[model samples]
Target chain A: MNGVKRLSAPLNEKQLLNLRAGDEVSIYGVIYTARDAAHKRIYEIIKNGDKMPFDPEGQIIYYVGPTPPRPGRVIGSAGPTTSCRMDKYTPLLLEKGIKAVIGKGKRSEEIKKSFIENGAVYLVALGGAGALLSRHIVRAEVIAFEDLGPEAIYKMEVEGFPAFVCYDLYGRDLFEEGIKKYRKE
Target chain B: MREVHWERISKAVAELFKKINYYLNEDVYNALKKSLEIEESPVGKRVLCQLLENAEIAAEERIPLCQDTGIAVVFISLGQEVIIKGKNLEDAVNIGVAEGYSEGYLRKSVVRDPIKRINTGNNTPAIIHTEIIPGDKIKITVSAKGGGSENMSAMSMLSPAAGSEGIIDFVLETVKRAGPNPCPPIIVGVGVGGNFELAPLLAKKALLRPLNEKNEDEFWRNMEDILLQKINSLGIGPQGFGGRITALKVSIETFPCHIASLPVAVNIDCHCHRHWTIEI
Candidate 1:
């Protein structure tokens, strides 16, 4: 309910520390997009000790598979997919030095542990709000796995992209607190 | 016999795809507005507001409400006296889906094979369910089902003695387990009293009912009312962040079944809930 915080990508520890589970923030700067299939491929590539497409250090990855842009638009309706599908491969990405993730839904306990250990956080973009979310993305291009169509990883430049910190580095989870606060006997 | 051309059906299906995807249904839209008015949590209220805005933007810009344009699911009520004049109903529907998706610039979300994981390219081969009815007209209902909510759907065959309380528990448990994954403020469609497969089918059919509509049977109407309240009480809330208004509606359709079986299924639909019907 307070003023919306503005944060830049490749977020630092101080920034991550400042955020709480329910704080709303609008992200700016570059973020990477990847979803179910791309995460699997990322897992295999990392397992084989191959070079990743981009530097993971201090980066934020958005779990999205955007629709194709109509003629003149930078991108189509880009929104967060469910985060759980990418849970299996998330630890590997966090271990590689990713700073934060933007998605929807709760993460696994293992993922929560990794967030604390790796100094990362999880953010949630409103699900089923694609058309509104797309308004924040200013530029987009496929950065890897072009053959996967919508599943391809894209590098996106976003301005004022709204998200809520769902799982924080301090082990506070908004999802858990949320249920407790709202459920009336 | 009343004769109709397959091409006409295909063209109508194509338009249905274009219109349904671009605009949210009035009943669903109004239900969300009402949820926005009554939602308690600030975050939950914000989510509902965004959903309404998203629906408006999608409609004004002619864009999809969600990127997951969904799998094409069709329910057809064909009159016994109606004769198709062209190729076939199923083929025509597939062609329409392909054209509508491509021409309207909707995302093709379907895969050609589930295991191999190949993109179907055109979002074709719709899941068509047909029932032969008594009249000379054809009625078609089209729903574009996104994978998220569809994946959370569940079915169970309970002993007749498990009874009503068992059903209440099962439905609540299914929803509680789903949490935010199915995109709460969801629509829960429940099927009761049918055999295993038919129960799930009926559950899916229940979703096709208008959000503002309730079951005609007094017993089922009361069941819908209670289920809707209990689901919201779970505090899953909008986008599962917790608040009032977790589900917009709960619909239950039933069928007579064998004395030994009481099959129940829950089919969840996200708040986006897209579908349309046409009679020809």
Candidate 2:
């Protein structure tokens, strides 16, 4: 098990603060999937003063656009998209009470700052390991923006979904620290 | 003259996309295995292991290796002495791509227009690059490029005087800025000396070559080795978690150009390397 930390969805402030960068986490329970288009729409809903599709309080948002599953599978190759594309929209979501976000790649300095202020965390999944990650997603159902196809938000039930803490509430960044530590000249 | 049907092209294109998406190429697979033995960071080692396992699971289960099955980029070489029976070359390729994505259950990632941003649903209208050669055979290569890595690609027009050092610096800077965004342990394809358009195409083509293949010319061969070393030393490591194996390979392609132009382009490929070729 390599001391892998077990976590559940809708993480609390204490749990978010306890995590450290680079800690391998096995997450369970509900995590919502949203990528570029859905984020835009969610942001619009907020801008228009409409009721949010789902409450964002203490919820984990996974940035993904999964493939269509084969007949027997619940989901297809599901993995993290780049985190940077959602950078412009993240602060608003954080303010709306998103506790954690999961994806691959770098987040902006402002996004990191937002994480600290909101007491949220940033985690990343294995970017291209969709087949491996799909095994942990036991259920998936589109909850909004079905028109967006793969880009729609899906409420999913996950079990032992693998991720690593990339940004914690203290404003530490795994990507920045890891690169600096290993960079030679 | 030889006669080839468009349907065969479509069938091959469809099969090729499916095969490439579901199965990791043997060279890339072996490289990851080798990297596992040498990666120093514990998390980097774990990531390498997970990638190998992902490939196995993808192949065994017959699902795509990644959700971003990628925009279809096809390169075709048609023999000058050949005739198509069913459809035009471009139409045949796009039809094949549409069939493959829909039938194989690959994600439809392409937007109808760059600005409008509407999904085409079937993943049609593949980006096709074609050339006419001497023989009567048709050769095609299909690559699925993920948006995450593709968006990080860059190009620049340097002064002819900037020379090789300038290129090294540009490529290094691009990698540094990309950090983990392109999904490190990336494959960097560099093109030098072509015009604005050709330079990027040449860079994209460099990615289609096998990871184990080195450039034929001695200068380019050494350049590849140097870039590989420099990139790995960046220590972005696998998925930018940080470690010794940031880049698995760096391939450069070049062409003669105007003395005044020194255009260079770097196209980054994620570790998936979803490319396959067929000859007919």
Candidate 3:
């Protein structure tokens, strides 16, 4: 793993290229939250030639459905959910110019290939580290699908949100290396 | 007959859910701490450290440990000598669950049906498992089982002669396949020799045992050690980043089975095993 790098959201090509699998990053700026249900909604919206709740271009979508914020708090224990469930709709979002994604667990081989092809990256926040990650979220507002409750689309303003690059633009995958390094015969 | 009011049952369930969701069980917390001390991979250690910090934050701040507060799984050991008064037992527990999730601001993650997906709005209709025992008091254990780990669990009907080796292999294969998805330093709860359906139940129940507690039976305790060693050797590590501490503990609970069947089930519990028990 490389030293920690700092990057802004809606990452540019240069910023994306700088990321390699296993590199730690502290991301700042706007990110959006959408889990399985929200992704399905977004996919249908695109299929029907309709607009998404937010601009798809140059945006990072975090696979998350945060617990509702308590009174006077910006958010609850907000952390990334498992990302594998989003495999079906992720490539479609990438094709639409989505820049990066954040979640835990490995993506499918096909999704990783798309990340390389589309110059996108997948970030991993430690799973089950929800309360710790919430400290990084400065603000959260439901931008769409409020009926889905916690599954609604949230416009999140984050500062120094910590994650590691698990899948990168160049087709590197940290999870693969992780198993190889430690698996005993 | 000892009479227990439905309101008391509901209140107990609600309070248990609220407490367990926000607080990490001391056994699980200590196991994670011990795992952190010996985790070989730097990344794995870092992840474990974050999990530790998350637990502290959740407990101190009174927030749900993870956003997925989970489908409520309640294990009730009812005393045969006691009589429950009020709404039926299941209804009372569901009412308590609804109150707990709503009042405590925990996420309501239960869907109405597996085939027809619809959010239940309030986390209700808990997966309740009840057993009658000879006592005047009842024991209830509530576990907030997260979906990620629960999805990784598996059951198999091994050949009758497959024996202990077969059981070991099944548990190993399950953890290997689970990889990072179940959130390692997982607790492997293995149920061997029970009937097909009961095997999984036994496996889930095994998870309620404290990490530091060994199986009361020597043979099973040794089996737990072997399985745990083999699992950690797979290098799944913390959060599946690769390390020597893939599992914090392996608990096996068994029951006599029919001669024709050797059913084995593996139920994986994430490091954030949110479960608590109270005697009422």
- Give the winner by lDDT: 2
Report the lDDT of model 2 for residue A99.
91
List of clashing residue pairs for candidate 3: none
For A52-74, candidate 3 gives per-residue lDDT tens digits of 89887889999888887889999
Location of the lowest summed lDDT over 10 successive residues in candidate 3 chain A: A167-176
Error of 3 at A126 (Å): 1.0
Q: Per-residue CA lDDT of candidate 2, range B140-233, in tens?
A: 9999999989988999999999998999999999988888888777899999987999999999999988998999999999999998999989
Model 1, span B154-195: residue lDDT tens? 999998899988999999999998899888899999999779
Which digits, one per residue and each the tens of the lDDT, describe model 3 over residues B1-280?
A: 9999989999999999989889999988888898888988999888888899999999999998898888999999999998999789999899999999998999989778887668999988899999999989989999999999999999999998998999999999998989999878899999987798999999999999988899999999999999988998898788877788999999999999998999999999888898999999
What does candidate 3 score on TM? 0.98
What's the lDDT for residue B14 in model 2? 94
Recovery fraction of native interface contacts for candidate 3: 0.76
Reference-based lDDT, residue A178, model 2: 83
lDDT of each: 0.90, 0.92, 0.90
For candidate 3, what is the DockQ? 0.81
Candidate 1 residue-wise lDDT at A16: 87
- The regions of model 2 sitting more than 4 angstroms off are none
Q: After superposition, how far is residue B167 of candidate 3 from its true place, in Å?
A: 1.0
lDDT of 2: 0.92
Per-model TM-score, in order, reads 0.98, 0.99, 0.98
Clashing pairs in 1: none
